[model samples]
Target: MIDGLSFSLLTPPLIAFTVTLILTGWLIKNNVLKVLDHPNPRSLHTRAVRRTGGLGMMLGVAISWASIPAALPISVSLGVALLVLVSFADDIFGLPVLGRLLMHGAVAIWFSVALLSEARGWMVATIITISVVWMINLYNFMDGSDGLAGGMTLIGFTCYGLTALLAGNESFAVINFCIAAAAAAFLIFNFYPARIFMGDAGAIPLGFLAASLGMIGWTKGLWPPWLPVLVFSPFIADASVTLAKRCLSGEKFWQAHRAHYYQRMVRSGLGHRNTALLGYILMVSAGVSAMWAAHEDIAVQLGVGIVWGGIYLSMMIVSERYLERCPGD
Candidate 1:
């Protein structure tokens, strides 16, 4: 038996994993929500798959978060609930993109204002609010491939939890660990030939939490703001760069396309499994470095960011060159 195992740490993740596994299995068996994701021009998957995995994953996270109420703020919890409801509606009824973005912006602004209060100016709040919205949409943008989003969630939150634990913030650590564990459970069916997709219901709220929790931790002094950005940079870099490229080419940047670096890798013969595995390697490396640098001085943290920026740049250049040589339809 493992000695010194605290129930506080063990119980929440256990609940998260068990709930996600069982619910996901049930969703697969029943197709209860019946939100089928079909192949599209931008889709990576070839056939229709049930996208109800988000219901199971978010349900598990909600249950676990409820169990550890002290770890999260009431406002953030409410924001997540709002995102889930609106996002699930979008999945079912296909809500207008503008309307959905409005809702996203509203919640982000509210959260940012509450988070900053009188401590910061409107300019700072505006930037963070925009960032929160970007994170929400960017995560949705990056969820096209198998195992990519789930793997990022697992690694990113684990890094966040570990950083909080190192800083002696047990409640915050448990909150993040539960999310990571739930994502791990989601990955059981999401890897490679995926059985289900998280859909908007799952991805939007998770993106919100990723930004919200990271900002919360920064405000609370548990970790630097750069740490969260670094940990989630895999998704960030790919989505932002792709968006930029599309805009530069005078393309409809908001419309879906296989322009993302990872999507290109998949189309360029990397396949889903290898692309996901390689992505896992990048995610783990980024998260580990972020965690380590969180405890270092300002100079070291800045250096870490610069180094990772260079690495991401190199990877993108290599991927673009490889794709130019093998341009897949």
Candidate 2:
């Protein structure tokens, strides 16, 4: 038998794997998943498939919490539970936009309040709340293609896990490991030629957890703020620029459309798998930049930011050109 095996090393991933298998099997058997999901004209898939894969993610997280000894902060745990509930309800019954936004706002406030009660100052609390809400939504918006969100979570948690290990933050490392394992299992079904999609249910909560953990890591001085930003830089640049352009053109931001850079690439005949791989390439580059910047001076960090900004602008230009040439919607 393995000596001194802790729940941290054993339980989270195994529990997540078991939960995903059971959830997927149940959804397939009861047809509850099919009631809300169907192949549509705008979709990339060819057949009807379940879309509430986020249920599995939430279940995995819950199991992780139970398996470990006070593994996560009470506030953080509650916040994640709230997000999962709202997201799952929306997946099944479709929540009003205002209600969803309100829920996100409430969770952000709760996190801020909890952190502040722990002696964090007001300004820091404000920044944390805004950043958490924004990152959660960004993850939700970026969940447009197969394996995209899951892949992002995998890379992000891996980076954070390493950072925690190097910093000797073993508890945080366990949390990140759990996240990475959950994302990995989801990716098995979410990869290109997906058997199922994560829908908003999984995407939003995953995003919230990733963003929250990154923030916590930064606040505790275990990692720099730049690290999480670098891990999610590709999605950030694309979503930010696209939203800005849409606002400038007076387009309805909430309505669905094929306008993101990745979407444009797909329209230009780049396969979804290829587009996702390209995103992974960019994420890897950003991860390398982050690792290099961890020890660099302020000037070097600023220079890196400038270089990344230029690269983002160039990609946007290319994407715009591709969209212009593609057939009209």
Candidate 3:
């Protein structure tokens, strides 16, 4: 049985959720920071919303993670802190892209080496490093809409926690669940017509965890890399396909635009709430399926992959046709 889930362990994330909720409310009420994210062509929300709500989630994670007496590496904690620090500063001061990217690259390299410690070959190191960095960017790219990123985190990490439990890795399970709980709390204020956004501070660190923790579990033999990819497939498929299409069309991939499948669905008249809810449904389905299929044999895993592939392909085909039919809607 997945015995790592006890009331004591659950308490931390519960406390985190409560604190995050209260803290987010306080920020919204006080308008804590004067800085706001104004609407541009790419924005889903039309009004200026305070994006500092990421602070609450950060606080929740910090307090709860501190409560855990586990002996995780100090360097890992330091790297995560640095990422949040840089992202938070950028959220407030709008730091230059080059500097932010440099910081991201530095942290990515450190963790890439740590995660790939078992196989120090240059090719392995280089590939995983690029993958982790891409995860960070892809996550940020997918966070434009309300509740989208938060919901994905909840589902994705919870799936990770479940897989950890199955692997008898109680410590990893608790950590993943804690992150999920905090994200759930953030979702309270971040849902459709959000009063506050998570901004870079929340998004960046979360993206880092998604890749790092996923790799950690893989290294430990808790789950295969494909499992995490399937766990976060909704996001992976959307962001990767969009990025590829943009590159193929010679578009400036670094620039922001309302081009993601989720964004396009919203712009095509689905609205934020519907699009977000549908995305959540897909997340839950994919996560649950991955969680169940992780224990199966390689043949079973391959079969699962093929089925999901068809499903995603069907979605792409149907969505494209539906949008075309409603081009002026």
Candidate 4:
């Protein structure tokens, strides 16, 4: 009785949203995991809060995936599972940074080489593998602020779902929509004055999915490879630039710090709520533009990239000037 992209197709995301909302609320109320993120020199928040929101969000995603008939590639599914297990371990018992990086590299290589090498060749796959590893770490780097990662996940995955739908890939759309929906629910508790954090367990897997799913969509002709880059340009830009700056200054890039543009914005009196709002604006604009340019010719897509590149450059300059003028107000 329903029309195209009807109830059946939409049910999975709704289930995902509901499950995450209920589960996240329960975890917060009961202090289920007792994983507390306390304030630290590098932290943005001043008080301790639960960091088990990732557990609820991922459980929601897993349950929703179980109900859907569409199956992700076995390599991707296994890679995500491994990340969740290891990241959750890192969350509870402090794992060595070297060990975590090795695991991330192994998973990235597994996903990229095992699945992508035949289609894109080993050289291209190697580059993608490195990008996947960067995405994993960059996501964790950007998860310091309230609502930042959650908002990015919701907007970024929704863009992926929309592009897949436009490409007539209903199953793929459902998968992405499920991710966005779960992120949306997670945002309820993660917004300014956060009740919980997604921790490494959530950020790591979400980052992997962002890169791997985007690659899958590209290989399947759902969208161009660059579209994913454009959709997530906000995160990629900030993290990449910050890392480069640190490395050039002879600072250890791997150590946690509050030097990200967003972190500085918050510390410079922008506050978490406004900083997150600005981030959401950037994310939504990038996502919408990527979706619009998905089916256009090469020139239009290139224009989109150039325009965003300029915007990011200008924003970074403005942030730098502001920091110099304010000087830790």
Question: What are the models' TM-scores?
Answer: 0.96, 0.91, 0.94, 0.97
Please provide, for model 4 over 116-232, each residue's C-alpha lDDT reduced to its tens digit, 9 standing for 90 to 100: 644568888888889899999999889999999999999999999999998999999999999999999999999998999999999999999999999989988899889889999
Residue pairs whose backbone atoms clash in candidate 2 = 54-202
Candidate number of the best lDDT: 4
Q: Report the Cα lDDT for residue 36, model 2.
A: 47
lDDT per model vs. reference: 0.89, 0.77, 0.84, 0.90
Better of 3 and 4 by TM-score: 4
In angstroms, give how far residue 310 of model 3 lies from its true place: 2.0
Clashing pairs in 4: none
Worst 10 residues of 3 by lDDT: 320-329
Query: Candidate 4 at residue 173, lDDT?
Result: 93
Residue 324 miss distance in model 1 (angstroms): 1.8
Candidate 1 backbone overlaps, count: 0
Model 1 alpha-carbon drift over 4 Å, by segment: 1-5, 69-71, 325-329
Q: Model 1 over residues 251-299: C-alpha lDDT tens digits?
A: 8887777778888888888899999999999999999998888878999
Candidate 1 CA-lDDT value: 0.89
